[model samples]
Target: MAFEHPYGSYNVQGSLNEWFRVNVTGNGIPAWMPSAFIHYDFPETGLISGHSGHAFSLTHQGADPIQQYQGRIVGDGQRGTLMESTLEVNCWLSREKAGGAYTHRLRHMGDMVSYIFQSARDVPLTNVYGSTTDPENVTALIRIKPANEQPVLPDPNPDIVRRRFLIDYRWLERVSAG
Candidate 1:
């Protein structure tokens, strides 16, 4: 996928793997999309790459009621929630940003656009979620509209609001080459 990086000037190339088990909640009731994951290649030479799981299956249930909707929102990075639910977004790794080591924008693609400004840095979980802590776990936040479209950051036009997901990059693992 190739698009302008939200934070820097670079193009994300290559297919993204399935990384980070994300929980979809907070922004909407009965969640529009399911608790899913996304994957990214370690940034190299200003060229980065990644993809949402199952980006091209064409499985979206935007119009259907919440009960009938099934998960699998991943789609091509540009489209509408009426047509496509999830999208493969542009990402970057930052050294100056305090929010996280990496950041990516998850967008609700349509005529009325909205964005989830995700920021994640390395943080070891010791006794946070459970009795056992994983070293690979990293804390991340997906900042939506009110949180994302702030004075200091670039505005994504908050008038058009959409469902957003809060992401946590836990259990860092490589996407298998199989």
Candidate 2:
């Protein structure tokens, strides 16, 4: 019988991420609230409350930890103490029937993670270090405006325009005060 290498290499370039998993336990998802120096971007709607605004939230239920939105770690090494399970990202819109619940997904690169969270079904979460260069992702995420709607100025926060958005986690940090 001829001897053959059963483990012969086929292709191992970008297949490593196929099994990539990380459990981020840094106080869970942050509660993002619009800063006081902010202006109304979208039209006047109940979606964004005048007080707290519509903060984003995550739910472990139905949240798949297989691919995206999967990270776990312990108190050992660079990991945390508890093995925080991944969660499903959902939002609580102040305005009824304002936002759309579209199938969201997460994308990761190295240690940095980006969410596929979108308010409307059309919008998609764009990663900062990703190649999801679909402009629709932004438009879809924001509340669609009417054709006759007045044009608005660019957001002061450049991050909002960039694929990587700024999610204010200060609220989380405050509550976690030592």
TM per candidate: 0.19, 0.18
lDDT, candidate 2, 79-145, per-residue tens: 2111112222223333222223111211111012232212111212222232213211211121111
Q: Write the per-residue lDDT of candidate 1 for residues 25-81, one digit (tens) a residue.
A: 224312322333233333233221223211111111112111211232323332112
Best by lDDT: 1
Candidate 2 overall lDDT versus native: 0.21
Instruction: Evaluate all candidate structures by whole-model CA lDDT and list the values in order.
Output: 0.22, 0.21
In candidate 1, list every pair of residues with a backbone clash. 16-51
Off by over 4 Å in 2: 1-52, 61-84, 96-178
List candidate 1 segments past 4 Å from native: 1-30, 42-106, 109-133, 136-178
